[model samples]
Target: MTTTTPDMAPVRLYGAEHAADPERSYELLRAQGPVALAEAAPGFVVHLVTDYRAALDLLHDTETWSKDTRPWQSRVPESSSISQPTQWRPNVIFADGENHAHLRRVITDCFGLLDPHEVRTLTFRHADTLLSAFADAGTVDLVAQYATQLPLMVFNSLFGMPDEYGPRLVEMLAAMVGSDPARAGEGAQAFGAYLAGLYETKAAQRGDDLTSWFIDHPNGLDREEATQQILLTLGAGNEPTANLIANTCVRMLSDDRYFGTLTTGSLPVQHAIDDALWNDSPVANYSFHTARRDVTFHGTRIPAGAPVMISYAAANTCPHQGVPADGFRSGNKAHLAFAAGPHACPARDLALLIATAAIERLATYLPDITLAVPVEELTYKEGTIHRTLTALPARFTPLAPDADGATPWSRSSADRGSAGSPRTAPQTGAMASAP
Candidate 1:
């Protein structure tokens, strides 16, 4: 008798001595080979697809790796406290086959119609107003003042609401999902309740904003369903976007050459985004998935019904086969901060545009703007799913104009925000000891 079994061993992402760094964790997986078996639970298992090529193989292979995990009631309960089997709201990303495709199409039509040129224009106008507020101020917290506030303001129009709600929503969602799962679930529930109220209000009017189409869809969406979709969208859409802008600024500020390239017009808005997407991806993880059937990667066998954590962050940096063919330069690419395959982010187009608009506006207008503190002072937010900044202290002095008599404020620079104590970074030695 000849018998052969795939290699299945214990490989821990987090060693007892050190927390798992995404980059380091991935390299370990790569060294072990493309795919490895992980014990997701005692006596239960899932495949861990760690390498870029193998991940893409599994992600796009819907037949072998299905997203349709029906009969999930006993599996993914709403909350540990709740006796209820499951919440009825599942985003399109969680669905598989035609159902997923259909939902994505409807949502895209509802909110994806913005003209890029107009977005860019709006970004410039908003930047002008925001920059003007802080031009005189020598320093400010970039995250609290600008990064967190901007996308909420920009995306608010899509829903046709007052920018006033953006701050509240941002706060609630921040608590709900960024890193802390338990706290985030609490926040998610609260936000869900608020969304239910808001959707009911919008349904009555059936206005032209996102609510109208979503609420009374000919296809069908009741108050509960509509609320769930909206809640999911808001959570999924905003933070990554805000983080994207914040990340871009952080990366550029780290190196004068990167900033100079943008300010000098060597890089357009889109190019800057591409550079950042590769260098400083914002949302660095996607939800875990399960393999529906037996599959193999690099000769590693994955039995049916196993959970898999696809490393989008790892896949993005693959030297040979990362990103789509068209986007990769030298086939070297950025982090898969967004995942690939079936659950690839649906709002990618909008996120990229919004980010580019922010960058272009800043680069074109505030060429001389510089961070008040050195980039080393920054604390980069990193975790299983999100990457953002706690703060980026910055100061800007607009350039004096030529003989043309053009007011420097009009052509040169614009908005500033949040009159907090100017958040200058402490000196290295001082920062090391304080707090």
Candidate 2:
């Protein structure tokens, strides 16, 4: 078994190298053991669970592990970024036991009420709208021009936010998730305030949207509860969906296996999406579970209150037990991309629909699309939780606006007109140097 001597320093997850190529770091950790200790941020040491079975066991054992980070309050100063509460409010992600069930039920019920067909239709419309803005430019950054905006627009429509609110919401979420110490708190507060206003608007005029459903649900969530739940949903939905689309598109563009099948009409978009999930999940390492008490398992010791993170990317790609590096594809959805156990992502279906629709639309509209830069030149965003591209530059044959001013995939008149018109491409050359 691989082992780390005390003289060897723990792997740091904060550097540009880790962000660019975390799989390599995960491989190093997996070599140490299934459960390798690493420093996530300054002064924050976490047990990184790199084994698939071990991660599942810990995820399902809420009694032994809790999502609450309050245990670290005394140890980590309030000013420390790591000390930030996992749950800004009493929402499902950080809740436990009965509270978790109650909050999850409310959110799940709201999401369940969403018609999958409607979700797909909305996703297609948003994809078309985003693509239209850069379709005229033969060279475009897919990450900024398409992937980043589609999910945000879809969530905005689902939450019944005004068109004007979408950009601000995106800005706020970017700040909250970004590494800027000064802006993170400000972004959090601004997001909360925006949600509060949304709650008020939905209360006064309940519309046919997810926000309205939360208000009308039997759970009778208070304003604060409703706002927190919305935050959780939007926060959980946007970045992952964006990354999934960008990743899948990159695969479709760079890999001849996928591109060849696309031209032959043999491979499904879902197949590409599933492959991306197994290979490079958007949320690479997350689901932070703190030890309820001192524990030793998998030849590693973890103290009570110590943070344990599930390395989704490592576990999925783990070669142990004869699993392939690309993950097993037995036509089974066993991959932990959406996670597992009771706390698995509630919007799994919706997220898949959104991603599949976005990719399908791209393939339909830009059949000739290809990567503008070498596949090796792409860079991932700098963060621990998300594995997202900073930019995805691609070259494609620019298409003229349809006669109806709608993308070929657009099915509704409401999705027509200037929204699908060509516009100037965004500036590029911001992606990081490849490792």
Candidate 3:
């Protein structure tokens, strides 16, 4: 979707139906035109940037499309507030230019500075508990047992919260996942309250966790402000990480060929993780931005104050955009799973490390953990903002290492190699193999 009054190249974007399937969705829009105006919500129309170069140009040049919360408020306005939009100013995420730079710097060192030792320690700790529960059980849902536990633990420990709070955070995050941003205010309120509680406890004392960092650092937020940030992170961070790992598992189990590639690859499973982000975006759409100025994309004109959406899912999958033509190529991991340019996720490094370690270890631990469920049966909770997958049930025969692949349990033919009852999990294919 080009924003040139007539200066540069035209912008490329997709249509509405592609909201759920952005990659495919953008293709149709790009085919329709380089720039397509899309109705993302009621009385809202955004110019989709389907073309790669154009998307790159616009995302980086914040001068043109700013993330300033004052200029353009999000339809899902997740502010660091006790109440809704009118109640408070924007959070760190909404800041632009120097403001964004300064706030981002507080945690700038945190991502890269995240010690591998920490990741190793937490992964093993959570894995021990999770796998023990599934031990000897012929058919266990890996997503529930393995995939979900690791990242939440990583986030909780990193944030310095107790294990008791982890379940509550995960539960609250599930509530916000697919709810409309406007209607999700209640979730936001509950999250704010939770963060306030956390802030009060951490304010009294200090520790090495992120909460303590925020409390002590001059550049960081005060306990109350930090609490809001924590709430936002918990709500946003939990599911994306969970979905990335679970979705990867589904991708890997779907095809033996892909699984075999992972197994034998000299490189680590990082690329495979990228493939999951591009192929199946966990956060499907980031929508409903009010246009700050008069801008015309393609022939369709959008006056100032129009709602625009930057569809990262659609952008990554477009042939003309990111990733090489060969989707399976190991080097095509530069997909836009973590948004792009100015708004690129600060947690990119940490998130990737966590996902890679989780998936790599998973493929190593349970090569026989195939999907026990079908694709269509998998239900996704959808709202104007995201695509949140609820349950991924799979029946797999956790046979001995020598049991070969897809063992059929005894007693129940479907349960396989006998031990547990038949279960269901939506099969999205497995993401990690041996690579």
Candidate 4:
């Protein structure tokens, strides 16, 4: 049992204070030692692992830690924000041992079948479509306009949906995870129906997409199993990838190493992405594990069934890791941005491809783009798991459509509103943890 004094009370991980400066929260956690208690929701306190070695050991020790959240879920309110991520599902994320391996193989194998070149080409196409919507405008919010939509559009195509359904899918997902409970419930239902219809279509006639591959795979998953797998992949990949893009872009634009010379710089986009992974990871805290029995983790005695989460942001910056004086983390990939162990991210390569291509494509079109406001003025969203910016306002010289009229955005301004605008409105509250 844990007792708290006035100075040792659990630190709240959500709201404006944590959003503005999550590092301060980490500082508080560190003072309590490697494993400390933090309030994930209003009243849900969980043990947070803030040290690198402890996080790694805990992640790899499956015998002591279980991914299953049923024990923890029974304690939290159905309406609590933590319920969404902690909710049990029939996917690899919540499975253990053999079940985890069985489900994960389906995802890894399907992802492996994707040709790197095709994935890059697909990413570039969507990036162009999104950029075209705002190329003529002198100012745009990269978070809303480009980063958030690109991954959703690409994943929709990969999952065998027609291009026309991309916008609606994005809208449904945003609402499903948005702050408003009523809208969130409605969005969840709509997204579920959408997934069912997608599986149905794929079942009737297979296409060369992930959905078709998932259905036709030798694993022979039933409709419900296949649907849950697809849902897991989509929900896991979307927001983290979006935030990776936005965070990398913001870092490059703000740092002198690449700000003015984004196109030609010693620090490339990959470096910025890695820096964000180390210092400001998109998935701040996740990999929820419950102690199988009484265990002393880093001198802290966590009782059986206690919820423990890994703080990727804190562990990556652990002073023991010794960040270089210059603050560059590109060549080094040891960071926990993707977590570790068997449950580590399976689609990291695809995410890297999409994020790199999105940033490179933006630079090709808007070489002179600059931030509309000071970097410090940018606001972050309030959440327990993700480090996301509310908006990324930027300015650039307007580029009109070419003389031959092949580019139609210049011809009609009204289309810009539909095309360039955010595919889904910004939502707050619980977000699905990326695997």
Candidate 5:
């Protein structure tokens, strides 16, 4: 097995090279062993688990691991971009044992209250509004205009906020997840303030939305508890879901097999989505855990409270796995894109619903859309936690509002105009590079 000396410099995980071709980076890390070292920031060497079996073992063996990051944070600089996501919060992601279960139940129950049909309808509605802005433009950046903003708008409607709140929320979340230290700091602060205002509004007047339900749940979470849960849901839901939509679109359009299947209606859209999850998991490497005590994992010795991260991308594409005879991964949900075990993403179903709806809606309107740049030229944004495209330039036939105004895009524009607040097209290139 590959090993490292104390003087060995850890592999850098944040840069254009790593983001552009993470599979190569994973291969380098795997040469060091299933559990190898990588530099997450300038000086922080985090243990990254690359083997599929090893990752599953860690995800499933929670008793030996703790979700809390308090001990590990002491070693990381407070100003580092890597610190923002891993910083201790009392939410489900950081809590352990009964507290985790308690918070998780509240979130699950709240989500359970959501109607899947309504969620799809909300997704379709937002997709139309976003598309209406650029549906007539022959060339559009799907990443900047459509995929990035649709989820936040759907989330805003679900959380009992006016549609106007979507743009600023997008900015705040993008900055928080980006690699820039200063922007991440400011994003975190803005996000907290935004949530605080949301809670204040819901407390005064309850609405039929997730925020209101969270505030009034039987679990009886205080303002901070409820707000933290919302933060986790939106922050976790938006960027990854956006990436999934864009990634799936790219996959379906670029690959001839998927193109033929989609055009002939022989394969369902979910097939392409699952393939993307297995191959290009939106959340590349995350699910940080600290050792509960000194432990030896997968033949490697890890000290007490040392930080270990699971590479979902590396594990999903693990070279040892058996491939289907047909060379397709459709209908396989075994990948750890949403992670696994007790801490698996609770919003898995909702995220899938939103992503599927967004893709379907776009496909219906722009059936001939193709990548503006060759697929090989696409670049991902630099960040350790997510695999985000810097831009997805696409060209499609210009779709104009029907003369009778029967199309969804036309109807949506008409409704907005009647509301005395027409939705303007978001500025091209205004979208933040990473979220």
Candidate 6:
């Protein structure tokens, strides 16, 4: 089953069915050619590059392929969802050349200031706080109760946002990514206004947060640029992390290969994360590159100003890719989940840290966790770029929150393991076990 626009060519990825099982669609697209053209939306045809080597070449050929969408302004309708203006933003994601480097350096440096140990600590704390809300309920939607809220809480702390503003910001972000296209612009506007307020507040009184750091950075970003950078971080950071956590949990609960070893205290949490990255990356497809001029590569001609989107999902899973031959092997971080080239994700390390901590803590606290519904019933949110689960309903033995706001089987407890008991060396696994 495939969907097509008025032109009768298959609409590459804009329906519920495709979202549910995008890999199958990717297979079909790959069958056509390495570079298949399809309409992402009505009258908005895009080149979906699926071949691994081809994608890398395009990504690295920054001179021929640009990130700027200004050339597309005249080609697409102003109101079209795929129009350049609709997605235009002056952030690292859309910038090229020196502009891209300048914006990205500040973000990279800001993330570098975060201590990995501290990030893990904060992640565990936020995970515990969110889990406490649903730990008493034997059955709960993990996506809503834990996965979705954990990153937002952690980001709120990182940005030093006021407690009152966190929930509202999360709500606006959710609405922006939600099913309703009508609300996206409104959400973007609200998000900008809220960040502008944060910028003003941080300007007047600095805090030990990324926002403050950006404001005071030697790069000298003004309030508007600072706000856009904050928006970029939040927009790129939150949903992908949420999806990673949820996706990892789903694997832990459903896959006997991992579940059996995890229960037996053999499988490392990082292995599950790496596996998810290879097989089911949260942000399935991204890195929209536009042709700087008329170019023909691999026998396909991409006209000047044509929009090209790389299929990270398809590239990672392509059988001919040859990197992960055995599937989800630990220490194999070659997957393009973080993308490649100059515009790859800057905060990938932080993302991995938070995801590992969240998953490890969740597994430790709820060792008996299982799916509330059949695996077949799990559905994905519909979209071209993201592979987000609609919800993750899970069942686990109810755990009581400790008086000190810690789980009985928290990391410390796992480390100390009952004061007088002889400490056995922790079991070695495919990946380094979480500390």
Candidates, ranked, lDDT:
5, 4, 2, 6, 1, 3
**Could you give candidate 6's per-residue lDDT for residues 1-435 as a string of tens digits?**
222223335546767778878888888777657787665655667788887888888888899998977666455555443443237688888999998999988999888888889888888877766777787777889888888888887888888886567677778887876557779778878987888788888899999889999888888887778888888788778888999998888777776556643325556677778888978988887788789889876657678888888888898888754455557567688788888889889989989888888888776666667788988999997666777888988876665545443333333444434543322332322112344
For candidate 6, the 10 contiguous residues with the lowest summed lDDT are 422-431
C-alpha lDDT of all candidate models, in order: 0.57, 0.77, 0.57, 0.82, 0.82, 0.75
Estimate candidate 1's alpha-carbon lDDT, on a 0 to 1 scale: 0.57
Which one wins on TM-score? 4
Badly placed stretches (over 4 Å) of model 5 are: 1-9, 175-190, 260-263, 325-327, 409-435
Candidate 3 yields a Cα-based lDDT of: 0.57
Candidate 6 at residue 331, lDDT?
68
Model 6, which residues run further than 4 Å from truth? 1-8, 73-86, 179-190, 261-265, 321-326, 404-435
- Residues 244-273, candidate 2: write the lDDT tens digits: 989988877766546642325435667777
Task: Please report how far candidate 1 places residue 409 from its true position, in Å.
Answer: 5.4
Off by over 4 Å in 2: 1-8, 73-88, 177-190, 261-263, 320-330, 406-435
Clashes of each: 12, 0, 35, 0, 0, 0
Error of 5 at 189 (Å): 4.8
Q: Ten-residue segment with the worst summed lDDT in candidate 1? A: 426-435
The count of residue-pair clashes in candidate 1 stands at 12
- Model 4 over residues 1-435: C-alpha lDDT tens digits? 333233568998988899998989998888888888898888888999999998999989999999999888887666665677778899999999998998899999999999888888888788878887888888999998999989999999899898888888888988987879899889999998899899999899999999998888898888888999999888889999999999988876777656654323336777777888888898999999989999888878888998888999999987864667766666789899999999999989999989988887776556667789999999999888888899999987676664344433333353233443322211221111111
Which of the two, 1 or 4, has more lDDT? 4
Error of 2 at 197 (Å): 1.8
Q: Which lDDT tens digits does candidate 5 get at residues 1-435? A: 666445556777888888877888888888888888888877788889988899989988879999999987977766665676888998999999999999999999999999999999999888988888998887899999999999999998899999888888988987886668799789989988889889999999999899999998898899889989998889788889999999988886787655542225435568888999999999998999999989878767888989989999999988755787654787879899999999999999999999999887777666667788999999888878888989999986566664444564433444334332222222221111100
